[model samples]
Target: MDPFKNWQDWRKNLDAFFGENFLSSFENILLYNYFPQVNVYKTDNELIVLANIPGLNDINNVDVFIDYQSLELRGNVNLKYKGFKLIQDELFNGHFERKINLPYPVKEDRIDATYQNGLLIIHLHRLIPDDHRRHKIEIKKIEE
Candidate 1:
């Protein structure tokens, strides 16, 4: 009594028993996201995330904050074109806030952010391990 299994096996049996367009129709539905698209990248010593926020935010209004293990991106997307009606309105407008869970805790004090060409680029430096903080080792010579 497993409710869900492999789609390939389930589809063949379900379609023959039911109908063909049932599954195909489900795939055609459009997906919507409130926040703009974002991409995250990692290096050995740092984490970089780029958010595509074109025509939505300015550098002064954008805010970047981190607490413990998560980074919160809260900002206002200005709807400058609010009064004008659009012939073809595809872009989303209004307020947008996206919070992302960071893989590693960064140096909260040394965070940097830059916005250029309608893209918000956030840079955070990784924190070094406590054990590696002190590299003092004791050397002993063997007494024969």
Candidate 2:
């Protein structure tokens, strides 16, 4: 409609395209942006989540937990700089958060987590139900 609107749309399109193209590079630049890497997988009895959190020193500062069906991870980054002059900055040096929804219920009490080499690994086991799911099937005839 207007110039501003046209520019906004064009910017959004450009961002989407460039973001996809540079995703790999962006992921590699965690020191600048604090992009937390995440890997999720599941088995019949367990679900695991691995997150890459670099430049974090204090374990108490990082808050990691799962509530209900969603896993909430959040933490504030600590800057490790000494008499540094402003030059170029693209990395997000601030608070970060990432949420992931679980497909099935996880055992909250049986969670195992460890943070090493800027990588946070979390392990969770599934809680199975006593009752089994029941399903019904229907048949249809072909018509000419």
Candidate 3:
């Protein structure tokens, strides 16, 4: 029998076995990079993205980019400790990048972003079309 069916199940089992804080250490040892957590919400006329990235004190440390249908996030978080004996550390550091696909077309020029209290919030205005219904496609027989 397979111990885990998917990545989420494996991560959950690992978290149960080693605890949440210790999983970070394990992930750091096994993985090359880390990514911040993000949540995306969509409405009829807008899309909102919230990224949880701790230790981002400088605005220059993070970058956000978006087009009509996609979003890209790139940044670096520094966790360098000088002259101190390190114990347990759960926070993720170093460079990270994440890309997200938006559900609807948006106006790229009307996008706005703000970072506060370790959370990066982005608002994108959706482009309204004359028709919002899905168009049916007619399948033609391909001559092979």
> In model 1, which regions exceed 4 Å deviation?
1-31, 132-144
- Give candidate 2 regions above 4 Å deviation: 1-34, 132-144
Model 2's number of clashes is: 4
lDDT of 3 by residue, 15-102 (tens): 8887775566565655434266677888889889998888887879899987678888999998777998668766787888987778
Over 61-139, each residue of candidate 2 has an lDDT whose tens digit, in order, gives: 7898788567888997777488887586554567888777776888778899899988888889886766777667888
* Sort by lDDT, top down from the best: 3, 2, 1
For model 1, how does the per-residue alpha-carbon lDDT over 93-129 read when each residue is reduced to its tens digit? Answer: 6666777777788888878888888888888888776
lDDT of each prediction vs. the true structure?
Answer: 0.70, 0.72, 0.79
Better of 1 and 3 by TM-score: 3
Highest TM-score scorer: 3
Error of 2 at 45 (Å): 1.2
RMSD of 1: 9.6
How does model 3 fare in lDDT? 0.79
